[model samples]
Target chain A: MEGSDKFFVVVIVMSIIFTGLGTYLFLIDRKLSRIEKKLKEFRGSKNNDK
Target chain B: MIKSMWWKFLGLALVLYSIIAGLLIDVPALPVIHQTIRNLFYHVSMWFAMFVMLGTSLVYSIRYLSGFRMRDDLMASGAVYTGIFFGLMGLMTGMIWAKFTWGDFWTNDPQLNGAAVSMMAYLAYAVLRGSIDEVAMRARISAVYNIFAFMLLVIFLGVLPRLADSSLHPGKGGNTSTMEGLDMTMRMVFYPAALGWILIACWLLQLHTRRRALIQGIH
Candidate 1:
């Protein structure tokens, strides 16, 4: 407590409100993976038709 | 982003921890950079992440040369783009830090100039790809160029900077032990921050590769 700075608290508090941004990035990454998988399967099935 | 969930979560957790701990942790009071020492968690972490992603690009480019697979080329380009993004961030952050400590936004330091040269070389890779009309030719040529760019990257960033007699930046001018200044508390946060940013760079590269793969597959 003796050596602590108050600016840290303000920035921390501000950062708290933006906590979900990383979760959003994570979700988009997962969603993109799903899309990529589906596209791969579609291509595979089409290749089988020939 | 690489069809892996655990590493992404770990990246997020570690970065979040570093953000909090980086702020709260006590740093050694040295001249010129007092509280700004906390910037080590961010500015240095970014350059590390940039190196990791660009190194991945170099590896994938070599893989493409061996196999000539379109997918490997896509991955190489994706890693390059992500690496460039991180490198740009590193430059911006360095500029900000330099303004405070070195009393100028851009100095004549060899380290800083070398970083600029490397960034320009990578940027040319993107421009080279865009100008090519054919897919296979673009991939092959750009893959080759990517390797050359990475070699230049290693030279400009690693070799030229150290050959200088002195530098405003740490770890330059034969002063290789930049991490030696970190104490235990700083080390705890800095290591996690570096690793987290590297993983996050991987996540971004995977995202770019997947999107590119999907787009190429549709055509």
Candidate 2:
């Protein structure tokens, strides 16, 4: 590959990596939010019992 | 502590700047490496980030040893997992850069071998964790093992490479320091790129530990 073409390839690889990382972070954030909500509900029910 | 968003945004902004400036900024022209030097920001930064993540793990492991808190153990493992993720990125990006510059996908260079060894050591930690069933025992044993593994990491990746007689990778016995070729212009983008990735790694570690905490209810 020409020099410019190789640079482009590197750029594409970086972009793909960035996308994968962003997607993973977003999914994990969503999962944690769900878990926090559930924990809050559980605590609220326990408080009601008291 | 992870609730703050400012640092996360700062990490994102710095990374964006590095990506842009790294690509567009004029780099020193040298034989063999040429423009591939631009990879300094992306490829090398991954290793930097990995180092910080593992360092964080080391701190948490020591904390676990002192207090024997299961939560500290969990956070330690979380940092390890995150460090491994960044290490994988570093490995892949290094492979790509190697193919283009060194004309090989993999080489027998000391630094490369050291990195591979360090990664396997951490992976073994994961496997070690899987073997135990009891909670406290798992935490205690893994915390001790984590410290050992980190020491191995430092020896392999940092010490052995410098002790080697010769290596294609920089910072070896004969080679100049890793930052030697990075002229002032390149340093502008490089430092922030590294710091940005380190912050991003911390953010990922926070998310990882938060998920682990919620599932295990240790926190």
Candidate 3:
């Protein structure tokens, strides 16, 4: 394969890998935010009982 | 700790720059390496970020040992997790680079073996953390182990490999390919790539720690 062509392949593969990893991170962040919100609401309700 | 988003944005921007620049920038077309030299920005930077994360883990481990705080323990564990992730990525990328350049996916080089050993040592720490049932005992014992393992990691990855008579890796055994000798064009992207990766790893550590804290708080 030509040198520049090999590099282009690398660039595409790397971009895909990074994009996938970034998307996974974003999903995890969203899940954490949902869990945190639920916990806050639960705590607020418990405080209201007192 | 998650209040500000400036550092996260900076990390993202720097990494984006590295990705684009690393590809388009001109590089020294050395024999055998040629375009594969661009792996320097990705593979080497992963190790750099891993070291930073593991160093942070060591500091938090020390703090946990001294203060016995659960938060410090959590931070130390989170950092280790992130560091291990980077280490694995570094190994995978290095192997792929090596396959192209060195004609094999693995080598008998001292540097490669040392890196594998160091990673295994950290994995043992993770297993150690899992075995103990009591929270306080697990934290205290694992904190001590983390400090010991990190010291070994430094020696394995940094010092011992350099002392070897021969190494396939550059910048070792008195080789001239050290970072100081890197072309200015490459350094322009390399430094930022390393720093950006470290920042992103820290961001991941913060997120991991926060999730752990929230879960613990609920329990």
Candidate 4:
């Protein structure tokens, strides 16, 4: 491959990797937010019962 | 602590910018490095992020020792886990860059060996954390070990490598420091890339810590 072609290939590969990683972290963040909301609701209900 | 999402957006934006700029920007077409020099923004940034994460872990470990808070212990563990992830990424990227530039995936360079040793030390820290069954004992013992291991990491990555007679890695021996070698354009992307990766790692750590907290609360 030509030098510019190789560099562009690297750019595509790196973009894919970075985008994939960012998406994974976004999913994890969303999951944690859901779990946290559930925990807060459970605690609030328990406090109301008391 | 993970409530604010603005920093997360900022981190993602900066990283995306770095990815685009690092590739397209003109770089010094030095002998042996050429286009592969762009790996500096990616690979070296991973190590910088790792150091930040590890340093944060050490601070939390010290706090856990002093106050014995479960939250601090969780933060410490989460930081270490994230730090190790970055370290592994750094090593993998380094190996690929080395293969292209240095003609081998692995070499006998002091910096490389020191990095390997430092990673092994952290892995041992993880194993140590896993071995104990008691919560309080595990936290206390692991906190102490984390502090010691972090010191070892500094020595291995920072002190020992520079002390070597020669190294293929830049900024060691007679080679110019990595910062000294970069031009203004590369430096602009490089600094932001490092900061972005560090922020992203911290975000991951915050997520891990929150998950642990939720699990503990459920129990």
Q: Considering every candidate listed, which one attains the maximal lDDT?
A: 4
- Model 4 lDDT, residue B85, Cα: 95
lDDT of 4 by residue, B90-176 (tens): 999999999989999999998788778878988998999899999999999999999988787676666666678887777677453
**Per-candidate TM-score against the hidden true structure:** 0.91, 0.85, 0.86, 0.89
Candidate 3 lDDT tens digits, B1-219: 255656875776678778878998989879999988988988999998888988999999999989999999999988988989999999999999999999999998987897788789889989999999999999999999999888876666667666778878777785534585689999999999989898899889988898889978823
Off by over 4 Å in 4: A1-17, A20-24, B1-3, B174-177
Model 2: residues >4 Å from true position, as ranges? A1-38, B1-3, B174-176
lDDT of 2 at B209: 85
> Which ranges of candidate 3 are over 4 A from the true structure?
A1-49, B1-3, B174-177
User: Which CAPRI level is candidate 4?
Assistant: acceptable
Ranking by DockQ: 1, 4, 3, 2
Q: Which docking class does model 2 fall in?
A: acceptable
User: What are the Cα lDDT values of the candidates?
Assistant: 0.83, 0.84, 0.85, 0.86
Candidate 1 per-residue lDDT over residues B5-116, each given as its tens digit: 7888888888888888887777899899989999999999998998898888889889989998888888888888888899899999999999999899999988678778
Per-residue alpha-carbon lDDT of model 2 for A1-50, expressed as tens digits? 23554665665566567766765776677678777988989989999999
Ranked candidates, highest lDDT first: 4, 3, 2, 1
Chain A TM-score (model 4): 0.85
lDDT of 1: 0.83
Instruction: Give the B-chain TM-score of model 3.
Output: 0.94
What lDDT does candidate 2 reach at residue A36?
90
Per-candidate DockQ values are 0.45, 0.26, 0.30, 0.44
